[model samples]
Target: MKTNTTTVNGIDTQALLGAIEAIRNNPAEAQSKWHVTSHWKGGTRSETKVKSSQLGNQTIAKDFTIGIDEPLELCGTNQFANPQEYLMAALNACMIVGYTALTALEGIELEELRIETEGEIDIQGFLGLDPSVKPGYDHLRYTVHLKGDGTPEQFERIHRTVMATSPNYFNVANAVPLKSKLVLESPATV
Candidate 1:
């Protein structure tokens, strides 16, 4: 299938592409700012905790605690997917919010929105069943349900904006340079 390209509000594709490329190459000079932090506690299921804080006038914080014996049959408590599902959920949630904000900013009224995401994972590597496989999701897909009065072109533009701007979506889709450090503390012998 042939890919489609269209811009919003009569914006030129070249201009949009140039703007995106400039931001990617010179992020420090970009006009937009993003500041957020997330903290998590506990392992396994006994207690899974998460909190996120954003910098803004309307600050908010929420927590999610998972029980040990919840049903996980179909994306629920008991069958909680390891960590990958959590990552997918983050992406889905971020995309929904990002799209909603973009549409609202564009003066579009949306009655409802829903996003369903699924990720396929291979467990052979983690289970030591296959030495050559990697323990991660091989494929991910998502469907967006939007209720609004707009042309297909408008929806496409909104979709692109969400995909390009969402932090979680970018983290998963792009290569981000990351580093890790380990700290050890011990009591000194007198």
Candidate 2:
């Protein structure tokens, strides 16, 4: 007798298993590529579009775009989420993905999983009121509330795995170098 495989939380379990098996067979197949582009629309607002990826022999393009803006008090129209908020969201979402994927990989069915993240930022630096203050979040906090069919020890192991393996979590915890160059554009002749 055979049981039909199904998707969980929008994740294809069979495909995931297949990918894991493929990775185990050939680690080079696990490397993935991603690309995104953003254009500044005015007044602290920008539109970022998910571009494309080279998966195997296919170039898949994403059709989704995200709008980013700050609150009115932060010199924005509050039309959308701020960049810092997006950072927190990315961290939480990455952890969620890790938890979901790892649980499925371990055959642990999850009844519920929730992730929340918070960070404290001092506006003095952003407003240029204090040169000594940092303009970014000095500290960030995140909480994961999970209720699953696993024991406490199992849950602890999952937490450790998520912390160790989550990409965004690792990124936020580690410092990454930024390379930027300013390119001035001339006004249009039209």
Candidate 3:
């Protein structure tokens, strides 16, 4: 008997299933490492270079440079995206992936989907002027706009699943353990 190959909203479910099967067979294949190097420019301007990602024993090279800055009101040059914008972007992007993949897996074809996210930060905390203030966002609000072949109930279920499964969503929504090490640069000499 011949089986139908499925592709919904440009997502190849068969390929996704194959990857899931591969990871199931060798759980170690689920390991993924991402790397980036950032250079700080004067007055809140900086650039981060994403060079590669490591999956198991293989290194995949996909180079891209991202620039970040703050608005003049925040003492930055306002040249590129600010760190807060990037934070929301990362969270949205990760959740979108889960949304799309899950939609495809459910055999639903998507017509449109998007998420709007916003948050507030206390600068006083960052500036060390207020010891009790938190430097990061205390609460984040997001709204999802979705239209697809699936019913509203199905979409709502998928949204919940995405929230539970998205890596960056969990990272941002929870207090993840962070470790830091600092190495002072040697003074330049001519």
Candidate 4:
């Protein structure tokens, strides 16, 4: 099927779809696949726990501890993934994987790929100073480093493809509709 492209928040959506299609067409050369879930725990330290479940088992878990508490250690039962850092990590990881897969499918020899992301947040929202404001990232920026044997044009195309198609990238760059649902679990009396 032919993929149609649209621009969202400065990203070329059509080119991104083409890149993903190219990668999916060649599955044998993919690098990594994983899923993650996280839950928030309200209290001091503002901690959160994230788990990675795969193949019917919880294989890995990490704690995201934030606040002014001596920089939570990532060694014991609790680790740190401070909210902002986690956001950057997600973007970096997604871009690396997406770019790698796309390059492999396009027959480009990629020696190295690195991505760095930074985000800014407003404190007013967190402190409840403004009810109309949202407590989320105000701006995000990314820098990508690529080393390969492709022309400047090819490299630019590959970069565009990765930025447009990556799920994490889309989550931050596009206007995605989100819905919240509450599920209550209770014990049944017999």
Best by lDDT: 3
| CA RMSD of all predictions | 9.3, 2.5, 2.8, 10.8
Between candidates 1 and 3, the TM-score winner: 3
Could you estimate the TM-score for every candidate? 0.61, 0.89, 0.94, 0.59
- RMSD in Å for candidate 2, one decimal? 2.5
Where is model 4 more than 4 Å wrong at Cα? Answer: 1-78, 184-190
lDDT of each: 0.65, 0.86, 0.91, 0.64
Clashing pairs in 1: 70-78, 71-78, 71-79, 72-78, 72-79
**lDDT score at residue 130, model 4, on the 0-100 scale:** 100
Ranking by TM-score: 3, 2, 1, 4
- What global local distance difference test value does model 4 have? 0.64
What tens digits encode model 1's per-residue C-alpha lDDT throughout 7-47? 33233445556766877887654553343333333334444
Residue runs of model 1 more than 4 Å from their true location after superposition: 1-43, 46-82, 184-190
Task: Please provide, for model 2 over 1-190, each residue's C-alpha lDDT reduced to its tens digit, 9 standing for 90 to 100.
Answer: 1134456545678899898898899877767788888999998999999978866555887788999999998899999999999999999999999999877666667889998888889999888999999998878988899987778888899899999999899989999887899989998997
Q: What is candidate 2's TM-score against the reference?
A: 0.89
In candidate 3, residue 74 scores what lDDT? 89
Clashing pairs in 2: none
lDDT for 58 in candidate 3 is: 80
- Which lDDT tens digits does candidate 4 get at residues 1-190? 1132254323355566675676688654344445444444442234433344332232445444333111334222234446567667877888887777666555566666778777776767877899888888767888898887778898899888887889898887888897879889798989
For candidate 3, what is the TM-score?
A: 0.94
